[model samples]
Target chain A: MSFLRTAPAFRAGLGMRTIHTSRVAAVQASKQVRAIAADETAGFKYTAENAILKGTVNDAVAVPTPNKAHGSYHWAFERLVSAAIIPATVAAAVASPTAHPIMDGVLGVTILIHSHIGFSACIDDYVDERKFGALGTACRWLLRVGTAGALVGIYEFNTNDIGLTELCEKVWKA
Target chain B: MARRFVQTNSISEMEGLKLLNTQRMNRPVSPHLDIYQPQVTWVLSGLHRITGVAVAGVFYVGALTYLLHPIYPAIDSAHLIEAVHNLPVWFKTSAKVAFALPLTFHSFNGIRHLMWDTGKGLTMKGVYASGYAVMAASVISTIYLAFFV
Candidate 1:
């Protein structure tokens, strides 16, 4: 058997002497998907962070592949959307529809995004793919489709109707 | 010779693991949410999310309902206003309170969250102070909006 030269994994060009042992069951790592254990799920294995209480020390850590979009950028985006809601809400409270028709549409979209992100966070926490399987996938897709439909609905309300700001104002008084 | 009163069973590695897993299935999860006494810190945190979901849920449902405008002509804003207007005075006031409470609480608590994001007001003392502050502010704001505004 050849030892890996200064690497955790065997490099592609490294030549290794073949070693066969009946004691150690051997299987190749999957090319398309990675699973921690032989019968484990592709994503995170632990149902909850607190599952460590019952877990073995040998359980593999679920290290996420960091992406710019889903990392710090997502946090920044969420904060930005939240901050944007402040002004949009103010405009909704005080602005006149006839004077600024687009303001209604702006508020609708901003609030929609903020709501979507909040719901998405809940779904991610509770309906994890590793735990909930098909149900989890369904919730995520439903959120997406619902968001799209809501966007269209908001657009229609803003364009054709008395607009959301005026509608809220009227409703509050009503 | 002392009498032995111990018994043991030899198990393969896989069998041992299976036994372990079976036992693990019945392991009680400690420090459950129900056992915790209600306090300002966690209570406010819970309320923040709950109120946020309540307010946002309404927003989403409203926006989604607008999609039905094409099919249901009576489902417009005018009809909604008329429907609410036709309700009794007590019902109207209570409805206003219902809407105002969650809206104000979520809004005020959200600012608290934003302050936290900027790495401010996160101390134990600061957290409590802010929690009380949010509660007061949200209550007053909701009352003002529901009763006066």
Candidate 2:
């Protein structure tokens, strides 16, 4: 009879040992889960703070200097190319009529005359720079163009019914 | 230690101007006219091209009139009359009107060119405004010649 009572106590002790072991494992797992969650939360908070700080610093530091510099350079470059290059090209085209080889003699002569005159004017400009100084440099090109223009005027006057031939004859004392 | 610095500066622009003026007291005073550079109309240039094309068109009209004149001599012989004629007053008047188109265009366009030669019509606003003026003048002249002979 004492042995039978000892058997029940021993079984109860075995059960208690199993339950304690399971409880210990469960506590360890819960602590590990808590640690993982804490770590994730800390990582998220750190990343968000870093992003906000970086964005604020970028706005404060780079906004004014970079923005205006980029804007003015872009606008000025665009305007310069449009205003200068395009008209210069058009003027060059006007001065050169050999682009149309099949033009009539009258038209061809007109074009050739203008183009040669233009080239001469360009040369005159270079010479003027050496001889006349900077003040005359500005007017030099104008003077050449004006001379060519005056010739064109004379041509028109000659062609018209204004008796320019008579006037010329008188001026020449012929 | 003691340091000494010389206090000498070059003359200012105003002082220089005063000195120059004092040196030239009896110089003749003439207002500078050419110093004021005039404005230019840029758009008139493009219009000048257009009017040149119009002048070519007028030439073609004259050519066509010459070609068609003999077929309809009663209608209008002015276009076909290569030589001078002793015609009725109305026919003479019509002939004058017909001849005036190309001449008038040439004259007006020449004036526009003269304006350009003087360095006028170089700006955007000036260009467009001058273009408008050219059109107005061309139209008025065309109408006057076409109707009034």
Candidate 3:
């Protein structure tokens, strides 16, 4: 084992019995150890920083900021509106004969918004703009037009006809 | 070390998509719906999307029918109501119950989803608890809406 350790020194023409050569070998070994430790610490920091910067750059280059923000807020708001509709609907259903126009109007708007968001999300998931560019655009426009017409129809029903909840109740008894 | 850096500026969106597609093609597809065990999370997620479409469809169809009421008097609200009213009692109850069930289930499960969005009820225990809670709420609400309301 010792001969193996000394082989490189002997090949480099450093005599093993010389005190100066041994001291020089010890100094080189310590320097190499220090260099390795320094490299490890530096490598760790570089890798961590590189990972973070790469992630940021990729997001900025690949995804539009508005699209990213669109998803979370849209999802949360849709859920919020749907949650609010529950109590309003139950109350509206129970108070059938006496129609509350305001409550009914609120229900109409919330349902429109909720359904529009849901439909839009489905379209976003299923339709790839890169693959079906024109179809995707058309579907989105169709949704907008359909939502507007539905909103108007709902408004008319709530006002001219018996409101939604009442109509459901009436249908139930029918 | 210098050779490790990749120049991404020359890469077009189409090229990137092609690369991704190639990689996807090479990998064995895993966790496919047909092969994977059906779990609560995915089941609920699928149901959420389905219910969303169903509810929107109901609204769209209703609105379209109303718009066409001029041509078809039978589709008018009064006539439609009367038509439903004339149905047998069992049919009426069953139809209303079926209609109410989806609406109530979607509404209750939706609230649970909203809770998840807020980062609550995400643990396994929380998920199961919320799932059972949503089921109970839907049943109770459906019964009330169909019968009492």
TM of chain B, each: 0.92, 0.37, 0.73
Q: Alpha-carbon error at A90 in model 3, in Å?
A: 4.3
List, residue by residue over B58-86, the lDDT tens digit for candidate 3.
98879756766557656667888888878
The digit string of per-residue lDDT tens for model 1 on A30-115 reads 23342224443222244443232222334555668989899999999999999898998888768787578898788889989999
The runs of at least 3 residues in candidate 2 whose Cα sits more than 4 Å from the true structure, single-residue gaps closed, are: A1-174, B1-47, B50-103
As for candidate 2, its clashing pairs are: B40-B120, B40-B121, B40-B122, B41-B120, B41-B121, B41-B122, B42-B121, B42-B122, B43-B127
Q: Answer with 1 or 3, whichever has the higher TM-score.
A: 1
Quote the positional error of residue A18 for candidate 1 in Å. Answer: 37
Ranking by DockQ: 1, 3, 2
Segments in model 1 whose C-alpha atoms lie over 4 Å from true places = A1-57, B1-10
Q: Between candidates 1 and 2, which one is better according to lDDT?
A: 1
Candidate 1 residues B15-112, lDDT tens each?
A: 55455565555668777677899999898888888988998888879889989887999989889999988999888889888998888888888898
For each candidate, what's the DockQ?
A: 0.29, 0.01, 0.22
